[model samples]
Target: MAILDIFVNFIQVSMPRSNVIILTDPASQFSMEKSSTTVLPIQGDYSRGNLMLQRIMSYITFLEQRLKEHPERLKCINHYIFTDSDIALVGNLGQIFEKYHDFHLALTFRNNKDQPLNSGFIAVRGTSDGILRAKAFLQEVLEVYSTKYMKASRMLGDQLALAWVVKSHLTFATKKFSRPEAFSGDINGKLVLFLPCLIYNWTPPEGAGQFHGMPLDVQVVHFKGSRKRLMLESWNLFNSTSNLSDMLCLILGSGRTKYDF
Candidate 1:
Protein backbone atom coordinates (compact mmCIF):
# COMPACT_ATOMS: atom_id res chain seq x y z
CA MET A 1 0.00 0.00 0.00
CA ALA A 2 3.00 2.31 -0.46
CA ILE A 3 1.21 3.82 -3.46
CA LEU A 4 -1.82 4.54 -1.31
CA ASP A 5 0.41 6.19 1.31
CA ILE A 6 2.27 8.21 -1.31
CA PHE A 7 -1.04 9.25 -2.88
CA VAL A 8 -3.04 10.11 0.24
CA ASN A 9 -0.28 11.74 2.27
CA PHE A 10 1.84 13.24 -0.51
CA ILE A 11 0.27 13.35 -3.98
CA GLN A 12 -3.35 14.07 -3.06
CA VAL A 13 -2.18 16.29 -0.22
CA SER A 14 -0.82 18.63 -2.91
CA MET A 15 -3.07 17.94 -5.91
CA PRO A 16 -6.33 17.26 -4.10
CA ARG A 17 -8.32 17.32 -7.33
CA SER A 18 -6.55 14.33 -8.93
CA ASN A 19 -8.16 10.87 -8.82
CA VAL A 20 -6.28 7.55 -8.60
CA ILE A 21 -7.78 4.87 -10.83
CA ILE A 22 -6.34 1.42 -10.16
CA LEU A 23 -7.12 -1.53 -12.46
CA THR A 24 -6.21 -4.63 -10.52
CA ASP A 25 -7.18 -8.30 -10.39
CA PRO A 26 -10.01 -9.49 -8.09
CA ALA A 27 -7.76 -11.36 -5.67
CA SER A 28 -5.36 -8.44 -5.04
CA GLN A 29 -7.98 -5.69 -5.03
CA PHE A 30 -8.19 -3.48 -1.95
CA SER A 31 -11.66 -2.51 -0.73
CA MET A 32 -11.30 0.92 0.79
CA GLU A 33 -13.36 4.09 0.87
CA LYS A 34 -10.91 6.44 -0.75
CA SER A 35 -12.76 9.58 -1.81
CA SER A 36 -10.42 10.41 -4.69
CA THR A 37 -9.54 6.87 -5.72
CA THR A 38 -11.41 4.31 -7.83
CA VAL A 39 -10.24 0.69 -7.68
CA LEU A 40 -11.80 -1.48 -10.39
CA PRO A 41 -10.92 -5.16 -10.45
CA ILE A 42 -10.59 -6.90 -13.80
CA GLN A 43 -12.92 -9.86 -14.23
CA GLY A 44 -10.59 -12.81 -14.72
CA ASP A 45 -8.06 -15.18 -13.20
CA TYR A 46 -5.50 -14.40 -15.88
CA SER A 47 -2.47 -16.65 -15.93
CA ARG A 48 1.02 -15.25 -15.45
CA GLY A 49 1.52 -15.59 -19.18
CA ASN A 50 0.82 -12.33 -21.06
CA LEU A 51 -0.65 -10.30 -18.20
CA MET A 52 0.44 -7.07 -19.83
CA LEU A 53 -1.83 -7.68 -22.83
CA GLN A 54 -4.70 -8.39 -20.44
CA ARG A 55 -4.02 -5.11 -18.65
CA ILE A 56 -4.14 -3.14 -21.90
CA MET A 57 -7.44 -4.80 -22.74
CA SER A 58 -8.70 -4.08 -19.23
CA TYR A 59 -7.79 -0.40 -19.63
CA ILE A 60 -9.77 -0.24 -22.87
CA THR A 61 -12.72 -1.92 -21.14
CA PHE A 62 -12.55 0.55 -18.25
CA LEU A 63 -12.50 3.53 -20.59
CA GLU A 64 -15.49 2.16 -22.53
CA GLN A 65 -17.38 1.71 -19.27
CA ARG A 66 -16.46 5.23 -18.15
CA LEU A 67 -17.60 6.62 -21.49
CA LYS A 68 -20.99 5.04 -20.94
CA GLU A 69 -21.24 5.96 -17.24
CA HIS A 70 -19.65 9.42 -17.09
CA PRO A 71 -18.81 10.94 -20.45
CA GLU A 72 -18.97 14.44 -19.01
CA ARG A 73 -16.47 13.59 -16.30
CA LEU A 74 -14.07 12.17 -18.89
CA LYS A 75 -14.25 15.43 -20.81
CA CYS A 76 -13.10 17.40 -17.79
CA ILE A 77 -9.74 15.62 -17.53
CA ASN A 78 -6.92 17.00 -19.69
CA HIS A 79 -4.29 14.25 -19.22
CA TYR A 80 -3.52 10.95 -17.53
CA ILE A 81 -0.21 9.55 -16.26
CA PHE A 82 -0.11 5.78 -16.67
CA THR A 83 2.47 4.08 -14.44
CA ASP A 84 3.12 0.89 -12.50
CA SER A 85 2.47 0.54 -8.75
CA ASP A 86 6.08 -0.37 -7.92
CA ILE A 87 7.17 3.20 -8.68
CA ALA A 88 7.27 5.93 -5.99
CA LEU A 89 6.41 9.58 -6.47
CA VAL A 90 9.07 11.92 -5.04
CA GLY A 91 9.19 14.85 -7.45
CA ASN A 92 6.67 17.22 -9.03
CA LEU A 93 4.97 15.67 -12.14
CA GLY A 94 3.31 18.91 -13.19
CA GLN A 95 6.52 19.93 -14.97
CA ILE A 96 6.17 17.14 -17.60
CA PHE A 97 2.79 18.15 -18.97
CA GLU A 98 3.54 21.84 -18.53
CA LYS A 99 6.76 21.62 -20.55
CA TYR A 100 5.76 18.99 -23.14
CA HIS A 101 2.21 20.20 -23.75
CA ASP A 102 2.65 20.10 -27.49
CA PHE A 103 2.95 16.31 -27.69
CA HIS A 104 -0.12 14.08 -27.55
CA LEU A 105 1.70 11.43 -25.51
CA ALA A 106 4.94 11.01 -23.56
CA LEU A 107 6.80 7.72 -22.87
CA THR A 108 9.96 6.96 -20.90
CA PHE A 109 12.91 5.17 -22.54
CA ARG A 110 15.69 3.14 -20.99
CA ASN A 111 19.32 3.71 -22.07
CA ASN A 112 19.78 0.05 -23.04
CA LYS A 113 20.24 -1.03 -26.67
CA ASP A 114 17.66 -3.83 -26.38
CA GLN A 115 14.08 -2.74 -25.57
CA PRO A 116 15.13 0.87 -24.98
CA LEU A 117 11.57 2.21 -24.62
CA ASN A 118 10.07 1.26 -21.29
CA SER A 119 6.26 1.52 -21.10
CA GLY A 120 6.04 1.73 -17.31
CA PHE A 121 5.41 5.47 -17.16
CA ILE A 122 3.31 6.99 -19.93
CA ALA A 123 1.79 10.48 -20.03
CA VAL A 124 -1.13 10.71 -22.41
CA ARG A 125 -3.31 13.73 -23.08
CA GLY A 126 -7.01 13.15 -22.44
CA THR A 127 -8.29 15.21 -25.33
CA SER A 128 -10.23 13.63 -28.20
CA ASP A 129 -7.26 13.81 -30.52
CA GLY A 130 -4.96 12.38 -27.91
CA ILE A 131 -7.42 9.59 -27.12
CA LEU A 132 -7.56 8.68 -30.80
CA ARG A 133 -3.78 8.60 -30.95
CA ALA A 134 -3.53 6.36 -27.87
CA LYS A 135 -6.16 4.03 -29.27
CA ALA A 136 -4.36 3.81 -32.59
CA PHE A 137 -1.03 3.25 -30.90
CA LEU A 138 -2.33 0.38 -28.74
CA GLN A 139 -4.10 -1.16 -31.72
CA GLU A 140 -0.86 -1.00 -33.71
CA VAL A 141 1.08 -2.57 -30.87
CA LEU A 142 -1.46 -5.37 -30.56
CA GLU A 143 -1.30 -5.92 -34.29
CA VAL A 144 2.48 -6.03 -34.22
CA TYR A 145 2.41 -8.47 -31.31
CA SER A 146 0.01 -10.81 -33.02
CA THR A 147 2.18 -10.90 -36.12
CA LYS A 148 5.78 -10.40 -34.94
CA TYR A 149 6.30 -10.47 -31.15
CA MET A 150 8.23 -13.57 -30.06
CA LYS A 151 8.01 -13.38 -26.28
CA ALA A 152 11.09 -14.18 -24.21
CA SER A 153 8.54 -15.29 -21.60
CA ARG A 154 4.71 -15.30 -21.49
CA MET A 155 4.53 -12.02 -19.57
CA LEU A 156 5.15 -8.55 -21.04
CA GLY A 157 4.03 -9.36 -24.57
CA ASP A 158 2.82 -5.78 -24.81
CA GLN A 159 6.17 -4.26 -23.81
CA LEU A 160 8.17 -6.20 -26.36
CA ALA A 161 5.58 -5.44 -29.01
CA LEU A 162 5.72 -1.79 -27.97
CA ALA A 163 9.48 -1.81 -28.51
CA TRP A 164 8.98 -3.05 -32.06
CA VAL A 165 6.34 -0.38 -32.69
CA VAL A 166 8.57 2.42 -31.40
CA LYS A 167 11.55 1.30 -33.45
CA SER A 168 9.57 0.81 -36.61
CA HIS A 169 6.97 3.58 -36.32
CA LEU A 170 8.09 6.19 -33.76
CA THR A 171 10.87 7.75 -35.84
CA PHE A 172 12.63 11.03 -34.99
CA ALA A 173 14.39 13.42 -37.40
CA THR A 174 17.79 14.07 -35.77
CA LYS A 175 19.88 11.85 -33.49
CA LYS A 176 19.18 12.26 -29.77
CA PHE A 177 22.31 12.73 -27.61
CA SER A 178 21.87 13.36 -23.89
CA ARG A 179 20.91 11.78 -20.58
CA PRO A 180 17.64 12.77 -18.87
CA GLU A 181 16.61 14.72 -21.96
CA ALA A 182 13.09 14.98 -23.42
CA PHE A 183 12.64 14.63 -27.18
CA SER A 184 9.62 14.41 -29.48
CA GLY A 185 8.78 11.89 -32.23
CA ASP A 186 5.87 10.72 -34.37
CA ILE A 187 4.16 7.33 -34.43
CA ASN A 188 2.03 7.09 -37.56
CA GLY A 189 1.72 10.88 -37.45
CA LYS A 190 0.76 11.00 -33.76
CA LEU A 191 3.25 13.04 -31.75
CA VAL A 192 4.93 11.27 -28.82
CA LEU A 193 7.49 12.84 -26.50
CA PHE A 194 10.29 10.55 -25.31
CA LEU A 195 11.66 11.39 -21.86
CA PRO A 196 14.84 9.75 -20.57
CA CYS A 197 14.36 6.82 -18.20
CA LEU A 198 16.89 8.29 -15.75
CA ILE A 199 14.42 11.10 -15.01
CA TYR A 200 11.10 9.30 -15.46
CA ASN A 201 10.94 5.47 -15.22
CA TRP A 202 14.25 5.19 -13.39
CA THR A 203 15.67 1.97 -11.98
CA PRO A 204 18.24 1.56 -9.18
CA PRO A 205 21.12 1.07 -11.62
CA GLU A 206 20.55 4.53 -13.08
CA GLY A 207 21.68 6.16 -9.84
CA ALA A 208 24.59 3.76 -9.22
CA GLY A 209 27.08 6.57 -8.51
CA GLN A 210 24.56 9.23 -7.49
CA PHE A 211 22.33 9.76 -4.43
CA HIS A 212 19.47 7.32 -5.14
CA GLY A 213 16.95 8.03 -2.37
CA MET A 214 14.45 10.20 -4.18
CA PRO A 215 16.62 12.85 -5.70
CA LEU A 216 15.24 16.39 -6.08
CA ASP A 217 15.08 16.11 -9.89
CA VAL A 218 13.50 12.63 -10.20
CA GLN A 219 9.73 12.45 -10.56
CA VAL A 220 9.30 8.66 -10.37
CA VAL A 221 11.49 5.71 -9.35
CA HIS A 222 10.69 2.23 -10.77
CA PHE A 223 11.94 -0.55 -8.52
CA LYS A 224 12.48 -3.34 -11.06
CA GLY A 225 13.89 -6.05 -8.77
CA SER A 226 15.33 -6.40 -5.25
CA ARG A 227 15.60 -2.63 -5.39
CA LYS A 228 11.91 -2.66 -4.36
CA ARG A 229 13.23 -2.83 -0.80
CA LEU A 230 14.33 0.75 -1.30
CA MET A 231 10.67 1.77 -1.56
CA LEU A 232 9.94 0.03 1.74
CA GLU A 233 12.94 1.68 3.35
CA SER A 234 11.85 5.08 2.10
CA TRP A 235 8.31 4.56 3.38
CA ASN A 236 9.57 3.36 6.75
CA LEU A 237 11.69 6.47 7.10
CA PHE A 238 9.09 8.68 5.44
CA ASN A 239 7.51 10.10 8.60
CA SER A 240 10.80 10.53 10.47
CA THR A 241 12.24 13.46 8.56
CA SER A 242 11.34 16.07 5.97
CA ASN A 243 14.79 16.22 4.40
CA LEU A 244 15.24 13.62 1.62
CA SER A 245 19.03 13.72 1.90
CA ASP A 246 18.78 12.03 5.29
CA MET A 247 17.76 8.79 3.54
CA LEU A 248 21.43 8.20 2.69
CA CYS A 249 22.11 6.89 6.22
CA LEU A 250 19.63 4.06 5.73
CA ILE A 251 21.19 3.21 2.36
CA LEU A 252 24.69 3.26 3.83
CA GLY A 253 23.65 1.17 6.84
CA SER A 254 22.18 -1.42 4.45
CA GLY A 255 25.72 -2.27 3.19
CA ARG A 256 25.92 0.03 0.19
CA THR A 257 28.55 2.78 0.68
CA LYS A 258 29.62 4.05 -2.74
CA TYR A 259 28.34 7.64 -2.45
CA ASP A 260 30.71 9.58 -4.66
CA PHE A 261 27.98 11.54 -6.49
Candidate 2:
Protein backbone atom coordinates (compact mmCIF):
# COMPACT_ATOMS: atom_id res chain seq x y z
CA MET A 1 0.00 0.00 0.00
CA ALA A 2 1.11 3.57 -0.69
CA ILE A 3 0.06 6.65 1.26
CA LEU A 4 -0.46 10.11 -0.21
CA ASP A 5 -1.21 13.36 1.61
CA ILE A 6 -2.07 16.91 0.52
CA PHE A 7 -2.23 19.99 2.75
CA VAL A 8 -4.79 22.72 2.01
CA ASN A 9 -4.93 25.87 4.05
CA PHE A 10 -8.39 27.31 4.69
CA ILE A 11 -6.92 30.79 4.83
CA GLN A 12 -5.85 30.94 1.19
CA VAL A 13 -8.66 32.61 -0.71
CA SER A 14 -7.11 31.15 -3.81
CA MET A 15 -7.31 27.43 -4.59
CA PRO A 16 -10.29 26.79 -2.34
CA ARG A 17 -11.72 23.33 -1.73
CA SER A 18 -13.67 23.52 -4.97
CA ASN A 19 -10.60 24.11 -7.08
CA VAL A 20 -8.64 21.40 -5.31
CA ILE A 21 -11.34 18.80 -5.89
CA ILE A 22 -11.51 19.57 -9.61
CA LEU A 23 -7.76 19.22 -9.87
CA THR A 24 -7.72 15.84 -8.11
CA ASP A 25 -10.85 14.15 -9.48
CA PRO A 26 -9.50 13.05 -12.85
CA ALA A 27 -6.41 11.56 -11.24
CA SER A 28 -8.35 9.46 -8.76
CA GLN A 29 -8.86 5.85 -9.87
CA PHE A 30 -9.61 4.11 -6.63
CA SER A 31 -13.30 3.77 -5.85
CA MET A 32 -12.13 3.67 -2.27
CA GLU A 33 -9.75 6.39 -1.17
CA LYS A 34 -6.59 5.50 0.70
CA SER A 35 -6.96 4.45 4.33
CA SER A 36 -5.16 7.49 5.77
CA THR A 37 -6.30 10.11 3.25
CA THR A 38 -7.13 13.44 4.82
CA VAL A 39 -7.14 17.21 4.32
CA LEU A 40 -6.12 19.29 7.35
CA PRO A 41 -7.54 22.79 7.62
CA ILE A 42 -5.23 24.88 9.73
CA GLN A 43 -6.27 28.12 11.42
CA GLY A 44 -3.52 30.16 12.95
CA ASP A 45 -2.35 33.78 13.18
CA TYR A 46 -0.99 33.64 9.63
CA SER A 47 -1.22 36.71 7.44
CA ARG A 48 -2.64 36.73 3.93
CA GLY A 49 -0.74 36.66 0.58
CA ASN A 50 3.00 36.10 1.20
CA LEU A 51 2.31 33.64 3.99
CA MET A 52 3.22 30.49 2.03
CA LEU A 53 6.14 29.72 4.31
CA GLN A 54 3.99 30.10 7.38
CA ARG A 55 1.27 27.94 5.88
CA ILE A 56 3.80 25.23 5.08
CA MET A 57 5.15 25.27 8.62
CA SER A 58 1.63 25.04 9.98
CA TYR A 59 0.97 22.09 7.65
CA ILE A 60 4.16 20.41 8.88
CA THR A 61 2.89 20.70 12.45
CA PHE A 62 -0.38 19.19 11.31
CA LEU A 63 1.51 16.27 9.77
CA GLU A 64 3.15 15.63 13.15
CA GLN A 65 -0.28 14.95 14.61
CA ARG A 66 -1.31 12.82 11.63
CA LEU A 67 1.79 10.66 11.92
CA LYS A 68 1.25 10.20 15.66
CA GLU A 69 -2.37 9.21 15.19
CA HIS A 70 -1.90 6.87 12.26
CA PRO A 71 1.37 5.07 12.76
CA GLU A 72 -0.34 1.87 11.69
CA ARG A 73 -1.32 3.40 8.38
CA LEU A 74 2.30 4.30 7.68
CA LYS A 75 3.42 0.74 8.35
CA CYS A 76 1.22 -0.71 5.60
CA ILE A 77 2.26 1.86 3.04
CA ASN A 78 5.44 1.33 1.05
CA HIS A 79 5.79 4.94 -0.11
CA TYR A 80 4.42 8.28 0.96
CA ILE A 81 3.47 10.74 -1.82
CA PHE A 82 2.63 14.39 -1.27
CA THR A 83 1.38 16.97 -3.76
CA ASP A 84 0.09 20.46 -3.29
CA SER A 85 -3.69 20.98 -3.57
CA ASP A 86 -3.11 23.11 -6.62
CA ILE A 87 -1.26 20.36 -8.52
CA ALA A 88 -3.30 18.07 -10.73
CA LEU A 89 -2.34 14.54 -11.70
CA VAL A 90 -2.26 13.79 -15.43
CA GLY A 91 -0.03 10.78 -15.98
CA ASN A 92 0.08 7.47 -14.14
CA LEU A 93 1.85 8.19 -10.86
CA GLY A 94 1.33 4.61 -9.70
CA GLN A 95 3.13 3.42 -12.79
CA ILE A 96 6.00 5.72 -11.94
CA PHE A 97 6.23 4.07 -8.55
CA GLU A 98 6.36 0.64 -10.18
CA LYS A 99 9.08 1.81 -12.53
CA TYR A 100 11.23 3.39 -9.86
CA HIS A 101 11.30 0.81 -7.09
CA ASP A 102 14.86 1.55 -6.05
CA PHE A 103 14.14 5.16 -5.21
CA HIS A 104 13.21 5.56 -1.57
CA LEU A 105 12.85 9.32 -1.84
CA ALA A 106 12.21 11.76 -4.77
CA LEU A 107 11.60 15.46 -5.40
CA THR A 108 11.64 18.15 -8.13
CA PHE A 109 14.56 20.58 -7.95
CA ARG A 110 13.52 24.25 -8.17
CA ASN A 111 15.59 26.75 -10.20
CA ASN A 112 16.50 29.20 -7.49
CA LYS A 113 19.94 30.80 -7.43
CA ASP A 114 21.01 28.00 -5.10
CA GLN A 115 18.87 25.71 -7.33
CA PRO A 116 16.84 24.61 -4.29
CA LEU A 117 14.53 21.68 -4.92
CA ASN A 118 10.78 22.17 -4.90
CA SER A 119 8.92 20.59 -1.99
CA GLY A 120 5.55 20.57 -3.78
CA PHE A 121 6.04 17.01 -4.95
CA ILE A 122 7.74 14.83 -2.35
CA ALA A 123 8.07 11.06 -1.95
CA VAL A 124 9.64 9.31 1.02
CA ARG A 125 10.09 5.59 1.65
CA GLY A 126 12.92 3.85 3.44
CA THR A 127 14.16 2.53 6.76
CA SER A 128 12.98 3.93 10.08
CA ASP A 129 16.13 6.06 10.12
CA GLY A 130 14.91 7.94 7.05
CA ILE A 131 11.59 8.66 8.65
CA LEU A 132 13.35 9.81 11.78
CA ARG A 133 15.46 12.20 9.74
CA ALA A 134 12.36 13.70 8.10
CA LYS A 135 10.80 14.28 11.48
CA ALA A 136 13.99 15.74 12.89
CA PHE A 137 14.12 18.18 10.01
CA LEU A 138 10.61 19.28 10.78
CA GLN A 139 11.61 19.86 14.37
CA GLU A 140 14.59 21.89 13.27
CA VAL A 141 12.31 23.90 11.00
CA LEU A 142 10.05 24.69 13.92
CA GLU A 143 13.04 25.83 15.93
CA VAL A 144 14.27 28.18 13.23
CA TYR A 145 10.81 29.31 12.08
CA SER A 146 9.67 30.61 15.44
CA THR A 147 10.81 33.56 17.47
CA LYS A 148 11.32 33.53 21.21
CA TYR A 149 7.80 34.91 21.16
CA MET A 150 6.52 32.37 18.56
CA LYS A 151 6.19 34.82 15.66
CA ALA A 152 7.08 33.40 12.26
CA SER A 153 10.52 33.92 10.78
CA ARG A 154 11.43 34.28 7.12
CA MET A 155 14.59 32.19 7.16
CA LEU A 156 14.11 29.88 4.15
CA GLY A 157 11.23 28.16 6.01
CA ASP A 158 9.91 24.98 4.42
CA GLN A 159 11.72 24.58 1.08
CA LEU A 160 15.20 25.37 2.36
CA ALA A 161 14.77 23.47 5.58
CA LEU A 162 13.53 20.41 3.72
CA ALA A 163 16.28 20.62 1.08
CA TRP A 164 19.00 20.83 3.71
CA VAL A 165 17.58 18.17 6.02
CA VAL A 166 16.54 15.64 3.38
CA LYS A 167 19.87 16.01 1.61
CA SER A 168 21.58 15.07 4.86
CA HIS A 169 19.27 12.10 5.46
CA LEU A 170 18.15 10.47 2.17
CA THR A 171 19.45 10.13 -1.39
CA PHE A 172 17.56 12.16 -4.04
CA ALA A 173 17.18 9.98 -7.13
CA THR A 174 15.77 12.52 -9.61
CA LYS A 175 15.77 16.17 -10.52
CA LYS A 176 12.77 18.55 -10.18
CA PHE A 177 9.96 17.80 -12.69
CA SER A 178 9.35 21.39 -13.75
CA ARG A 179 9.89 20.79 -17.49
CA PRO A 180 9.44 17.82 -19.79
CA GLU A 181 12.86 17.94 -21.46
CA ALA A 182 14.51 17.62 -18.05
CA PHE A 183 12.35 14.58 -17.21
CA SER A 184 14.10 11.29 -17.76
CA GLY A 185 11.90 8.31 -16.89
CA ASP A 186 14.81 5.87 -17.02
CA ILE A 187 15.21 5.65 -13.25
CA ASN A 188 14.59 1.99 -12.56
CA GLY A 189 11.37 2.30 -14.60
CA LYS A 190 10.08 4.92 -12.13
CA LEU A 191 9.49 8.54 -13.15
CA VAL A 192 9.66 11.91 -11.37
CA LEU A 193 9.31 14.71 -13.87
CA PHE A 194 8.22 18.36 -13.84
CA LEU A 195 6.19 20.18 -16.55
CA PRO A 196 6.83 23.28 -18.61
CA CYS A 197 3.08 23.78 -18.56
CA LEU A 198 0.80 23.25 -15.55
CA ILE A 199 -0.09 19.77 -14.49
CA TYR A 200 -1.75 21.82 -11.85
CA ASN A 201 -2.79 24.87 -13.82
CA TRP A 202 -2.30 27.87 -11.59
CA THR A 203 -4.37 30.91 -12.58
CA PRO A 204 -2.20 33.36 -14.45
CA PRO A 205 -1.96 37.04 -13.62
CA GLU A 206 -2.85 37.68 -17.24
CA GLY A 207 -5.70 35.22 -17.94
CA ALA A 208 -6.51 31.63 -18.80
CA GLY A 209 -4.75 30.27 -21.88
CA GLN A 210 -6.19 28.07 -24.61
CA PHE A 211 -5.93 24.60 -23.12
CA HIS A 212 -6.19 23.02 -26.58
CA GLY A 213 -2.91 24.41 -27.96
CA MET A 214 -0.57 23.92 -25.01
CA PRO A 215 2.12 21.36 -25.77
CA LEU A 216 3.46 19.55 -22.67
CA ASP A 217 -0.16 18.81 -21.62
CA VAL A 218 -1.73 19.61 -18.24
CA GLN A 219 -2.85 17.02 -15.75
CA VAL A 220 -4.67 19.44 -13.48
CA VAL A 221 -5.29 23.15 -13.63
CA HIS A 222 -4.38 24.71 -10.31
CA PHE A 223 -6.70 27.63 -10.22
CA LYS A 224 -5.40 29.88 -7.47
CA GLY A 225 -8.42 32.11 -7.88
CA SER A 226 -11.78 32.03 -9.64
CA ARG A 227 -12.62 28.60 -8.31
CA LYS A 228 -16.32 29.29 -8.19
CA ARG A 229 -16.25 31.01 -11.51
CA LEU A 230 -14.46 28.10 -13.07
CA MET A 231 -16.91 25.64 -11.59
CA LEU A 232 -19.83 27.59 -12.93
CA GLU A 233 -18.05 27.87 -16.21
CA SER A 234 -17.54 24.14 -16.26
CA TRP A 235 -21.20 23.57 -15.56
CA ASN A 236 -22.20 25.77 -18.43
CA LEU A 237 -19.79 24.06 -20.82
CA PHE A 238 -19.90 20.33 -19.98
CA ASN A 239 -17.89 18.62 -22.65
CA SER A 240 -17.43 14.86 -22.22
CA THR A 241 -13.77 15.48 -21.37
CA SER A 242 -14.29 18.23 -18.84
CA ASN A 243 -13.25 17.36 -15.26
CA LEU A 244 -14.71 20.57 -13.95
CA SER A 245 -18.11 19.02 -13.35
CA ASP A 246 -16.70 16.24 -11.26
CA MET A 247 -14.64 18.65 -9.21
CA LEU A 248 -17.51 21.04 -8.65
CA CYS A 249 -19.82 18.26 -7.58
CA LEU A 250 -17.36 16.96 -5.04
CA ILE A 251 -16.88 20.38 -3.54
CA LEU A 252 -20.54 21.43 -3.65
CA GLY A 253 -21.60 18.01 -2.44
CA SER A 254 -20.49 16.53 0.88
CA GLY A 255 -20.43 13.19 2.76
CA ARG A 256 -16.81 12.71 3.65
CA THR A 257 -16.16 10.20 6.43
CA LYS A 258 -15.61 12.56 9.30
CA TYR A 259 -12.71 11.59 11.52
CA ASP A 260 -12.88 12.43 15.20
CA PHE A 261 -10.01 14.56 16.28
Top lDDT model: 1
lDDT of each: 0.66, 0.40
Query: What global local distance difference test value does model 1 have?
Result: 0.66
Give candidate 2's error at residue 198 in angstroms: 7.2
Per-residue lDDT over 1-261 for candidate 1, one digit per residue giving the tens place of the 0 to 100 score: 765555444455335667778777888857656777788787854568756766666656654554454567667765778777777666767678777778777778765655777767877778767766776676777677767763743665677777778877644422452355778878777888888877777665434464445334666667565665665676568657865555534543433433222
In model 1, the Cα lDDT at residue 247 comes to 52
Q: Each prediction's Cα RMSD?
A: 4.2, 11.9
Per-candidate TM-scores read: 0.81, 0.46
